[model samples]
Target: DPKVDVLGLPDWVKFIFLDIGLASIVFTCILGQLTTQVNASHMMIDFINNYFAVFTLYTAMTIEFIGIMHCAYLIKNILSAVSGKPILSNEPPKTGFTFAFYWVRVLMSCAILSFCVAVVFTALLAGDTAVSVKYPSISPPLAVVLLLFFMGVVGTLEAMQIAFFSVAKLPPSQRGTNWFGSKTCSLLFDGNGKNLPTFMIGRQLTVVCSFFLVGSFTSLTIVPGTGNNIFGVSDTSQAFLNYGFQGAVMTTILASIMWQYAASAFPVTFLNSLISFILLIVALCLEGTGICGACWV
Candidate 1:
């Protein structure tokens, strides 16, 4: 029957999600070849000094988006409970003026803000004399600290989302999910006893994000450049990996939420979000293929 469990999920959901994740990974891998050469100023100190900070900010933004998405998914059930809510069945992406839509729009805005930080890198911070003085052309290493900050943001975002979701949605019977780790009395136990919140998605999202991080660094090394352009990632294989990182991370989170939540956001919001997620995931997959090709040679 349709209700059969595949990897602890309904078969239909498992299939759809796997499709989304797989397609994305494959498509992104293809973009890798076009971007890996680094010919113009590939690995140049000036380029790295100029671009690394911005790139780090971008990466952090991307990661933060993923983290927030993760939190939302984790907490979907709990949030519904807070409202004394009930589950809704699966349906296509919809559009409407629902409470869910209002919340999701706000969430998406915050999620997208991470990459928006790149706006600073694109101009304001790029050649800013003030930033240059503070960061210093000679102090490229300081960018590492900036990079750390981005990672911390990602981590904090993830932690915050996880805690909120766990407490709010998860049952007290599911004690293991508690802040101190699962204990004897998680709130999620049924009469027969079972963990209500299945958490495999967290592990899956982590795997997908790890792949993007690897692909990004690897792609950076091999990614060719075109005339000292700041937007090299846009046209090349690196973009696939970079954006794929965005995609895989984003989509995985989305997939989890889709699997767990009630789809109240009407068609436009849902469709747009889905498309954005798919595009990135495919780019990552293609990025991986390119990485493999390089290894074989």
Candidate 2:
């Protein structure tokens, strides 16, 4: 009885239960969206069908990503502690740096999940890449570039999110009293008064890259979309709407990943980023090859 916590559940058992319950609820709603048909003509149904569905799918994917990443990190930390690893070793883990990856992981996850939803919708509603297009086709080089661009866009956004979070996480007492000095320094670095800046240079570069990306056509939305355009002025608007939902999902994922990996090492961050990068690359290749199948436009 003394060993058991509230509700007679061990801490680990409670965590497992929590994970399972959360995952089940998210997936069940996703299933509902996939199965239940709604009229596109009615206002509510139209919004649900066109807007809400995409939002729900991406949100679910983001939640799944965060949960999975957190569990993996928690397990690693438990193993390390059980193995009698020293926490305050000379090469101490830069937790702040690793935590920054929380933002990166969430953004990347959303990009991936949203991309999948787009493909699935295309396949079900229209046709896929089974048919060859002769008039205007994407060259292999161009396709690779497009895929890289997508990753870059996501990466830049990730960098910005990290910057914002890092600054926000700083204690008020740690911040500079002068507005001009605080604003100027905050624009460059991401850290409290204690540790050196983490990802400051990276953030600066990313902010510039993201600026160019925002101005360019490399984003999810395009001026003239190829869908029925019934959801909004164009299908691109719906894509943007899905993106908005993914932003909320990203916020939750960032918090979850950081809390779970609070005691984790740099290796955890590296491995997560590597996996996310690889997945994006594979997905891009699939897109290029037409193996994953394209949506009917």
Cα lDDT for residue 222, model 2?
24
Assess the local accuracy of residue 99 in candidate 1 as a C-alpha lDDT between 0 and 100.
Answer: 48
What are the TM-scores, per candidate, against the unseen true structure? 0.22, 0.25
lDDT of 1 by residue, 1-297 (tens): 446665697666666545324434433433332122232235555544657668978997886544445445435656567546565758555457654664675567446534433422342234421233332452333443443343333333233233434443445543243233332223223344422221212222333444433222211222335443334445464444433344334333433343334323221122223322333243334444443243223
Model 2 lDDT per residue over 217-243, tens place: 222232336654323445655555434
Local distance difference test, each candidate: 0.38, 0.39
For candidate 1, the 10 contiguous residues with the lowest summed lDDT are 194-203
Q: What is the lDDT of residue 71 in candidate 2?
A: 36
Give per-model CA RMSD: 21.7, 23.4
Instruction: In angstroms, give how far residue 28 of model 1 lies from its true place.
Output: 37
